[model samples]
Target: MPSSWTVLAVITVLTIYFCKNKRYRWFYIFAKTFRRDFRGFIVYVKTAITARLAKIRNETVVSVFESLVKKHPEKAAFLFEDETWTYAELNKFCNKIARYFRNEGYQKGDCIALMLENRPEYVGIWLGLSKIGVVTALINTNLTNDPLVHSVLAGKCKTIIFGSLYANVVKNVAKDLGFKSFYQFHESTTKEDFEVLPEFIDLRSKLSNISGDILSSRERVLADIQDPLLYIYTSGTTGLPKAAVVTSIRYMFAARGMTFVLRLKSNDVLYTPLPLYHSAGGMLGAGQAVLSGITVALRKKFSASNYWKDCAKYNCTVAQYIGEICRYILVAHNNVEPVKHPVRAILGNGLRPQLWKQFTEKFKIKEVYELYGATEGIANMINLDNQVGAVGFIPWHARWAYPVSLVKCNENTGEPLRDENGHCMECGINEPGLLIGKINQKKSIFAFQGYADQKATEKKILHNVFHDGDSYFNSGDVLVNDEYGYFYFRDRTGDTFRWKGENVSTAEVEAVISNLTQLSDTVVFGVEIPNSEGRAGMAAIVDAHNSLDLHLLSNSIKNNLPSYAVPMFIRVMNSVPLTGTFKLKKIELQADGYDINKVNDKIYFYDTKLKGYAELTKDIYEKIGNGTMNL
Candidate 1:
């Protein structure tokens, strides 16, 4: 993949010495590798070039989408269920949203939170708000109670627009939210959608009163490409969700980056069932229709049984997924024409090696475009060669140019390991190490925008990394690179754990559980189950008197946290294992997990059928570990 043979030969020899891989199988394999690596490098260069030109032209998310509306007016911009919205129609919907906010005196710097289920309107609302330079916070629709309230407040939002389905939830937390306005939107327009809880305003009614046309020049804010557009929240290593600022520049880089990587065509349709709050579904998926003039097939939510049917129905050429989608698709009964679907390529993160193989084979997929990145950091990677397990690859020679690298770090403390010279050490080939990205403030694509919380932002930056004045964005994830230069995700070295395709903070769960159980010394962690893509939640609490109320704990957790954050297993202990310093020691407890043979403490499993926690017997443990129970 080198421009010169000398560099390529040197790298080949080094790869052979380090990886100890068998000799290159055949000439055809070598030819294929050369082609893929070269092509991938071209994509990286192209993406950077396009992003820079957009910045120079002062193009933003709003301006880009407006151009597309004029270029492909009748093209299907989004397909949802049986509905299809053309590029022009989608633009009209967004115009109404922009006009409403602009007319209400929402200034350029105003911020509003939006919580809605995945639909065409979800993208429209945020994009519309961007027109007036009003940053829109994309709140996870699954959040409830305290987490939900925290999200709205974390964005520093003065107003919130929520879907009608969440009216009761918003009403309960309305008093907690002391901010200005509340607007509820009902997806259905055929029925009377004016219904709202008490003082809440109906967004649909307001929009209906206004003309759904393009905003006048005088009506718009002086938007810039670098202006903040969306506040997408992520649980970054701590308890509550931290809002990550996504500017028009950042969104364009990710969206346009994929356009080049996938060699996307105008006729290609993208199927995205993932949540709009997450970057995958929001920027990468929806960004296609807005920026690239491709059609996007949006779903309200993922349905394993209907996945393939939906793909064939929409004639989708591409599909999106996360870790949990693997279990869903593999375990489903069957979708009509499961193997005959038109989906050829997949784009998403958290697809394990085994899942990648099974998924591609089952669906006869031509390519699996596995990717890796975090919400705030800019260490983006893409698996271009369709390597079975690799999340991405960085050629040895390319490291000099690429901003990302793996550095030796303490697995326990989550700190980079420095040498006697006080410099971070690079991991050897195939060595697991912490991934970091060099921050370049001038380059929007390489900048670490960090979280809305500046203190939290500082927590993620490692200063004096390799040299005196250099700093790097510490991506809490650990990864390993092979002799072939392909990177594979190893494990996360933080308190956060992934479940149900969402990041569940142990600190958050502990707080909620401890509060419900009379201030018990509760510790929460993740436990691994065989055949599961991600870890399952488990909690340990001190209850020497055997007075812990399972019913109350279950109800409280369900009401406070998202369903995924609720622990699947709970262990009752007389006292939690603590270190000599009186800190809760989670290492051994997480290792014991819910194994009946290993865990001597009383263990209980959340019984969905019973609507409460039930004693975790040996039989129940066996059923869960062996994949026999669907519960």
Candidate 2:
């Protein structure tokens, strides 16, 4: 029972002693660990709060577009070679097209097929369809014959729009497919009244007659957030492309999430050379810009020499990329002033961890929002509040989750094998796994627009896993999750093949080879070596028409890939046959693999002793096949 003052003095002394000695000692260690986790938790909480707020208000993408038109009328909405369109101009253009669609008896939920390239008309058609509540099926222009005909008929499109440039491609396939009507938009003509071609309606005249003020009626057309807005086709690893029905809700979510992740503002200009047909260009790049009222600089295709020049010319603050595009840009000749552009950030997927630091340092880009998402998959990974080289984290959800598992391959056959329980176990951290999105009836959000071959669609749907009754979408991609829950891309399951005791992905090897300008498109696969333990890496390339610079090509591969992963044989071909969707047709190439005696193509083998590729003669082929030559 000490006096109150004496007790207070003792407590103060104890506090001071603890602060000076034991407490401070523990505080340093605690703060180091706790601060990182606490900050991560804060980010998680903030994201959750924002998501909840968005969900409560139910803000749709259509509403956001309308608001942009109202708020920023003078800002650039779309740009062509010499013409620039403001939001006001774009809104009017879209309404005119929408009114034409309505006048032609098109209704809500009707599907319209658009076969066009990267152009101003593409944006107009997209916005017009959105205003009319019609689902726009974006068809890849490169697709030909059956696949092309199949994709359009599969969506059950009421109308099809094609660029005048693709008229030949459409004419080759259209007669066979029973399309209701064909509409053409000619890029060469700027006339208000366009010439009407036989069996086709000109869009220009329809657009000229409609009033711009008709956009006020958009409120009635866009009343529902969950309505289907776009149908994006994703090529199946097995056969035909399957259309993924994208809703307005998903588009709105992507726009909001990307805007926050990229920290975009109205003044920011996003440069995209990727085609609008892909999700990366349409939903991520264009959608994000529209939502944030930012300007977008569109290019028909990517050119390495002209890329930095474009950025500088446009004063581009942001750019989007895919993995191959970045590698190609890096392979270009080094410049003393590589960081001359105004680009502050870049956002996209497929950027390899190895090139992360080098690319950022060279370009002087402060932020790299490397994001991950499938064209149709519900789960998306954004590296907003995380480090570079990581695809960011997704918290565990019992109902809906992507539980990745490594496919165990046979040493002899190279085919995936199942365990005794018939269940695949996931790989350890940083190891590759075939990512499978667990389908729980309670939480699944993706809807597959029926494929032309419905039976083909059924194959993509995996069923009865982890329970008596369950289903999931097979992503066909190998991925690994680190301890922090960041997903890292490994390889596509079908693309991974055994090569001299190593698993090789054509994409990984092709990515390395594409760095060589002498090779326009390279396809990597395994060619059987007689009496070998596994298949050896072989590459078939479309030469860049210059003398084969074997030394430069070999050096590039050696720098990027492991020794075993490098191609042992190289075949030079005039052209690489690609599917309608621009994806390399590997099945035929793998079938006709590297038998120099049988095949007509000029074959070259990597001469380790010579340090360059040399012509493969019958004698050398026999020696290599018999394991006499140490390849």
Candidate 3:
């Protein structure tokens, strides 16, 4: 038995020893993150954990939303420009949607595609449809023509509810589609401002004529946690958009995790300008309002110039972003005085380390909850300690609790490296490898609801991970974790390449180029160039119709994609050479690179100074190669 003073001395010595070395900082980070998440965890538990954990196990997005609406009926739910809607008002509107759809005979498991832009009504339509168990396929508003037609048809949607703004575009494709009905939603009461296409049913007037009361017992039973709720489209590596099935439990997980990890307050007004069709805006952004009773301010679309101004106008305390959104706002809104802005915190991913420090310092951001996850992938991580460039982390002492790992894999192809015993090898500290998460049915956080396509879903699963019989979700992302357990996103699978600090999916770019070229064959691939951090995009198109207009193509590319996504170079050919299997000979084209001396095709460079695609001259090509030309 030692003296009290001696015991205290020993405890102090042990504490100091454990907190020693710079490499042993995981203990501090774990404590900090745990303390920060404590409140959210308690609240989540008090709210009955999740739809999966509830007593009835019948918990769902609709039921949880109903609970929040009942609890905070008078609270402001959404603010869009000059309009504001209380939780009660929003709920009533959603009820009308449910009633209308039910009365019209839309049954459980029915699908309706929504092609509306970001608006309060957009949220209402999806929420309401979910009440009667109809899966809403959130179509990207930026898509046009063939790609738009593919997105709608992929979901097997018999009906499509589009905004009045997209009336003409929808009308052009209406004949091609097999939709039973086309419902049009007017953005304003003065619908005369926009043409009401004769083919579209007046959804606004129809909803106005229905009852806004709660659903009748005889109407329909809402969805279960395991049931499909929404279909969110993710750019597929194969081609076209893949409809990812977002189950009710999956939605609950995203919303609850965001609210908890962000430590959102009831008074927090979130300003989200990201498109609503994506999960970042649809599930996480809108979920904050629907699940937690927080006020959300909607933006029609992202305007970098108006980023902070909107925050100040909406009295927003929090903001949301994704991809190059932070970079866009940082560069475009450099004149914005951060001191006067009401935003104190930001939530998003895709902010590079160099840009992270600059953006936070310039904007006076106090907290940035940077996150890493996928729409269909199971692995999810968040940066709670504001670790620069780190997507998220799992402490070394608690990796068992996380069920995620970075396994050694082929750097280019992303195939997991295996040992002689047929077991996957885990990457060591600072070594980049494929990030994977174990699929456990009992753990809802690690549960992968997967995409709507059975083949697509099966393609993402990697088996025999660690044991003889084990499985993991293939994230298709290469990540490096340091000794402190901070995970940094390095790169993605070979098909996807990083450009301007953003992942550019070749398949998606090719899809856009193919459509823009009047259904001509296209091969989009990333080409490495001197004085570049990542690969630069180069697209090769087959001008089958010989109607390719360089100026029009340049303008369309700008409108369709982000600055980083646009290809820097273009090659025009009579036909794209194919491999033995009838696939585009990407290997041959990629090996050819962008060297003017090596390829016989007519090449053109996207010259920013000239503001259009210019035929590649020998001198100009040399300038690009020598780093004199800034892509």
Candidate 4:
């Protein structure tokens, strides 16, 4: 028999040999990152297996919630500001809301539009509606005017429930939506809460009844796993927001996948400040907590100033975020150690490469579960190893099982390029391309439950992607997968532009510009240059004071952004146009461009020699048109 010392030497040699191979290294690192106690691993295995089986076999999200509630009735389910609600308490609250919904003659299959901010009532109302098999249309709270009306009307909402803060905005469009019922609720009831128009009914009065009828009646309407439980609005970039169907099964799969992948436990507390109207907060953050019987700390709105303090106060082991949130937090505090908290992991989408390592190391975050998915997207990814700049990784063996794929695309047109045979070609490794997911109708699990509009739904399906009759859900986002199967988000197809023989991600450039304290908001896009081969970067900046120091702004951009990515033209405005979801409305910006005659905003051009922004007068514009003025 080999001695203990001899065995140790052999193992060490093997470890050193394996560490040299990238594939072996990734596997070893993954195992090390996922390492847990024997008992914990066993529990994870059992839970994952059970959840997978349940998801595959079609399980309702409400059933899962009820199961957890029964298992841990006394457990704290949610923490919002100074208030805490246990499973039983939340269950009772939801029952009262359900009762009110039932009294209004709402039944299974009904759709109710909920246009409210980030509050505990948002979750309660959604759960109550889900309990009665009524689909809840989560409208973006920031929406008003046409977009707001369009969303509510598009969903065919029977009623619109709004918050007090948006009373005037909703009132302005009340005549347009007079056909639908309206109800209002305030974050806290005051004299202002009761000062709503007659058309807007107060929802607070209905909350007083706590009969728990839905619980004991045993006659509550239940939906199938495949039935729509929620209608989450997509961030409308080009048009009005489309309501994406969130089936109970989709929620189940997402919740279970996150719980299993993150190793979430009952003791875990997720501090979520992302809006509940979106999937990241409403589904991923809340769903994981429901399935794992963990607590979720809610914030009225995401405040970079209060983010760390809230995590520390709540003892949050896990936190959620978006790319903007992380960037803002970093920019808000530039100290060596920006935050000191109990957070072990931060999970969500949109953590850019430039801010990933900087934010993590500075804030002392151990892991970042960078996620990638759309409200209407068919596939998802989760980073497990805290890989800097990677959205997620797929193990070699599991690649065949998942429907995700990347295909070559035309960056300028935001379209997938096809071969001579009219079939989409898969992109080579490390080459950024359109991310898509296979839609197999035969396999229910692979089927895409698309938007409520059939025309809109059909538009996203790409036919004959690989072969005749084969379809794939167009993700509309550009990504590249490394040799180790780690995926990095490049940019959205529409937001990426080719400039100076290179592609520039508007999101990346925007992140850099956002770090500047002078600019409150900015929209970056490609604009036409008279003699240029492709579009040149142009930024529409919003500053309240409108007194931007061109030299300072130019210096900041030069230090952070690439030469090609740097905006050649800058337009200063009092306000930045934004969609309901806070996404930049760039259509008008891109159209107006640098034409001083057409645009009223002040425009400046980068002078190569001067190394700063110079006013773009009519003479300079004419010179540039004549190809005399250098960029």
**Candidate with the greatest TM-score versus the true structure:** 1
**1 against 2, candidate with superior TM-score:** 1
Cα lDDT of model 3 by residue, 1-631, tens digit: 9999999999998888876875356666667667544543454454336544742567788888889888989888999989899989998999999999988889899899999989898989999998888989999886766667888988888799999888987887898896778899988878567767777789998988998988887875656778888999876456667899898878878887788777788889998998889888988998899888889999998898888889989999989987468867776766755546788788888877878888888888998888898888778888876888889877676677667999999764678899999989998989999999999866666777788788888888889989978889998888999876788998767577767644567887887777777755888888887745568899988887678998999998876665777899999888888978898887688778778899888899888898889999999989988967778
Report the Cα lDDT for residue 503, model 4. Answer: 46
Better of 3 and 4 by TM-score: 3
Worst lDDT window (10 residues) for model 1?
21-30
Model 2, range 1-631, lDDT digits (tens) per residue? 8999999999999889878845655555445445444544554444445545545676566667778889989989766556777888877778777878877888788889998888766877877877878889998765665557767877878778988777766777778776667888776566653444677777766567777675566433754666777888765453345677777666655666676667677778888887788788888878865666888888887787777788888878888887656766776636545547999888877677777887888888788888766776644566654366776555332113234333444323223445576654445657765666654333223343323356755666666544446555666666666545566765555655654322455665676677664455888887776644446788998874745677788886765455767798898888888889898877678778878767788888989998778899999988987867867
Highest lDDT among the candidates is held by which one? 1
lDDT (C-alpha) at residue 373 in model 3: 87
lDDT of 1 by residue, 306-421 (tens): 88889999999999998789668877844434466888898888888877777787778898899999867878899997898889888765777786999998887567899998
Task: Give the whole-model CA lDDT for all candidates, comma-separated.
Answer: 0.87, 0.69, 0.82, 0.77
Clashes of 4: 1
RMSD (Å) per prediction: 4.1, 11.3, 5.2, 11.2
In order of appearance, the predictions have TM-scores of: 0.94, 0.70, 0.85, 0.74
Off by over 4 Å in 2: 1-58, 189-197, 215-223, 333-339, 384-389, 394-424, 440-458, 495-631
What is the Å distance of residue 115 in model 2 from its true position? 1.4
Residues 59-166 of candidate 4 have per-residue lDDT tens digits of 677777777788988888889888888888877777888878887889898889988888677888888888877889998775656557878888888888888888
